[model samples]
Target: MRDASSGNALSDTMEVNDETQAPGASWLPRGDDWVLQLSGAWRGQRAALPELPAQDFNGAVAVDAEALRSWDAGLAAQLWQQLDPLARRSVTLDLQGLPQGLQEVLALALHDAPPTEEAAVGPAHGPLERLGERTKTWWADHRKTLTFVGEVLLSMGRWVRGKSDMRTSDLMWQIEQTGPRSLPIVSLVCFLVGLIVAYMGAAQLQRFGAQNFIADLVTVGVVREVAALLVGIVLAGRVGAAFAAQIGSMRANEEVDALTTLGVNPFDFLVLPRVLALLIVGPMLTAFGAAVGMAVGWLVAVGIYGVTPLEYVYASVESLTLPHVVVGLIKGTVYAVLVALAGCLQGMAAGRSAQAVGDATTASVVQAIVWIVVAASVLTVVFQRLDF
Candidate 1:
């Protein structure tokens, strides 16, 4: 072989021509120079480069990409892997035949030539530093939650003015989900709690020959606190998790982004319906739970404790005021709003991954329950001060 332009005879030339081979680069020894020939369509995952030989070649390397029909980032990556090692060994590289774009990409890829070194590991933060970091994170989260709540309130205002984009059918469906479908669990848990309260109260009252007062204990407790609290906790785990998982999955799939692209407000279309539905249904569920709870108390008082049914009913009714019922319903409504907000916030902030959806669902349930408990405590204190 000979160089046509230089008219120089080329001896000891090594030719690597394999037509059936996959897209790759091959190095051939020719005197003091090594010709790195890249062939076939070097595109995407299909571009395969062979492993470099273990033996060191102390010579110049010339890249020959004239046989390349097409190329992409994969081709650049393959070339970089080969060229990086050669450059480490101080071998000169001639990227003459490669496309200008590919040459630019390769140059940019390996511009920061750092000699490989062991990864440095830092010491863990002290307790005070960790606490400060946590406090900062909590404050940031609180601000985000407040902003989300404000957006939801604004969306509700839009709904009130009939300017919201949320569909009526979606709202109705949400109501149905949070309302009637929740009755069975609420009834069961409230009834059990009422029975437990009655039994415990009766045991103490019987010792003092004041068993008749069991009705007062059961009724006041169930109506004023237990029923609403139990319902809130139940919905926090059940309905709150559902809301988070649903919206988080939508976020993971970019459906929420699609809604934004279509000029739809996610707070109006998604969050508002859920919040309103839970708010409207919370009192209804609480009332149902309270009634079932009271009925269980009545059964315990009349059947086991030997109290007359009429006397039991009279005592229970007399112990409960309109204010007690109002307070419990108010708590239920507040808890519902908190649960919806927590779930929606977690869902909206979810990362784009399957694991993120699961994390959001778990966080939503936990946050909803914590908020419910905190709100319950505050409401109790306020109601007590007002003597409700």
Candidate 2:
């Protein structure tokens, strides 16, 4: 930098705050170079400082702050705003004349400043890229679920060998919760479903003077499909959500970690009993729901539709086959397993927070319902193909 004392005054100093002399800058000629003179207090937004000289900086430039009494970031900002463009234009800058602190601030600002132009945007993802990302996410989620299922299976093996931590009392409590405690809602729903089916069937059958056949329709439908589906749906909403919330809350409180520390298999102690309880109760509930639905259908047919009670009973008896009952119970078992798996998987993988427990509970219900529907469809298709 050219010495500020050796520079020749080129123009009168531009006074920004003449009354207070808040801060100002001036231009001077130094042979083939230029000198910027700064003076007065330049702290914060105390007062406006002089605008940068309009003259072009086509040679080496030096900032001279010998008269700068005190300053702050405000001064640094002004210098950057004014001198950054000149530096980009290849003007040799010598800021040594400024205070060391100000020089450092200016150096950092100039080094990290964003480009004057707008940044270019990245390209949009193609269909293949989006598909790949979705596939990866799907695999990640299912991998966790599969791992949980494997753990459950191993726990089941230990259970069979009488080496599991599953408690008989726990299993019985779960059975009470999943079976008897659930009967009221299951009965109400199935009865209403039966009433609807019977009414719909009677409406059409009455047209043909064949209202007696309403028993056949309701019996076959309820026993083979509706009862199991309604029971599964009820269990998914009630039992599945409960399992998730219980386990997830345990996880949030670090009880699951405590179990691991104590050498207890969490899957055995927490999950297997619940799963076994559901397995034992699932078919029983399906049968109960079927009976409730069939009874309600008989009431609708006999009392509302004026069909002969004896004929309705006879038709229902004729339509109720062992194969249909077996298929419905099998479906119930599968749905029960799926609901338990979904709930336990989400709970075990949940984050350690109340919100995560809530999310796991919600996800368990949703996943159970989805799996039940898919399983129902697949089972129906396979049974049809096999003539079962």
Candidate 3:
């Protein structure tokens, strides 16, 4: 071959590496600087470059732009696997004249930023800027989370109102279960209490030559304190535990989610009934406990102390006032609401886990006890100021 500008021979050859060659083929070259391409073998093979023709016009070998493009594209495809991403990227950018796709890929490589690696061992101040930025952003980023505290307060309100509207099933159950069923125990305990008080009082009174006054002392103490405090304590355990268990179970089963999906108010559906029921049952139970306690005192006085029934009745009439009964009932009702509210609130606040439920239950019991003690003390002070 010779260039028209100047007569000269040209040489070019295509060679394939053994790894890139066709199956079961041997490579051989047959030409001067240009040889017939062998199928495979890198030992004596290399792709020939475009030969310099006799003239600088270079007519020795024809170059196909499309062929070079195809070759470049193939090389680019393997870039990612063969080189570090940035290195591959640099290569790609250097060869960006290949195609639109290659250009985009190269641009992506150059512009792409790696996530800053969190170094287990690095410069101490490397993270200082990020931490400072976050601290600066903390208020803005966490505004919603902080505002959610207000939402929790709102939740408490909704819970309180919901409790106020509870269905009577639990409340009625408590009354029927706590009061009616507890009557025998109350009566027995009250009687023994009365007997003990009478004995204790009479022993002292007899020393003072006023044994007949034992009935008055037992009647007054039982009515003024024991009935109210005992009823509140019993309700704290029974009703408080029930409220926690009920609400906690619903939370565990995703009943709260069901309520959300159904667009039903969970507070209205769950808490209201219980709250209202307690409002109704509380005073009644207190009265029941008080009556039984008084009867116990009577039995203790007349049977054990040998106090005449007429004398017992007389002292009770004189010493036991209406204020005592009224105060007991009022305290019981208040305590009932406090305990129920605490239990339900804690339960509803529980997370969706067994441990959460247990935590809620424990918190509910503790809160109920605290509320009861505080309420009792407050009521005592208030009543002492007003009635005593």
Those runs of model 1 whose alpha carbons end farther than 4 Å from true positions after fitting are 1-131
Index of the highest-lDDT prediction: 2
Give the Cα error of residue 234 in candidate 2, in Å: 0.4
Candidate 2 lDDT score at position 297: 90
Tens-place lDDT digits, model 1, residues 231-327: 9998998899999999999998889999999999999999999999999999989888999989998898889989999999899889888998899
Task: Supply the TM-score for candidate 3.
Answer: 0.55
Q: List the candidate numbers ranked by lDDT, top first.
A: 2, 1, 3
Top-down TM-score ranking: 1, 2, 3
Q: Give per-residue CA lDDT, model 2, range 1-388, as digits (tens).
A: 4556334332224333442456767878887788888877777655554554544544687899888878987778778877776654445679999999988988765653322211111111577765665666568678888888899999999999999998899999999888999999999999999899888988999999998889889998999999999999999999999999999999889999999999999999999988998999999999999999899999999998898889999999999999999998999889888898888888887766666789789989999999999999999999999999
Per-prediction TM-score: 0.69, 0.69, 0.55
Model 2, which residues run further than 4 Å from truth? 1-124
Q: 100-164 in candidate 3: lDDT tens per residue?
A: 66546644443422212222112235478757655645664346434533444454477667543
Clashes of each: 0, 0, 8
In candidate 2, what residue range of length 10 has the lowest lDDT sum?
115-124
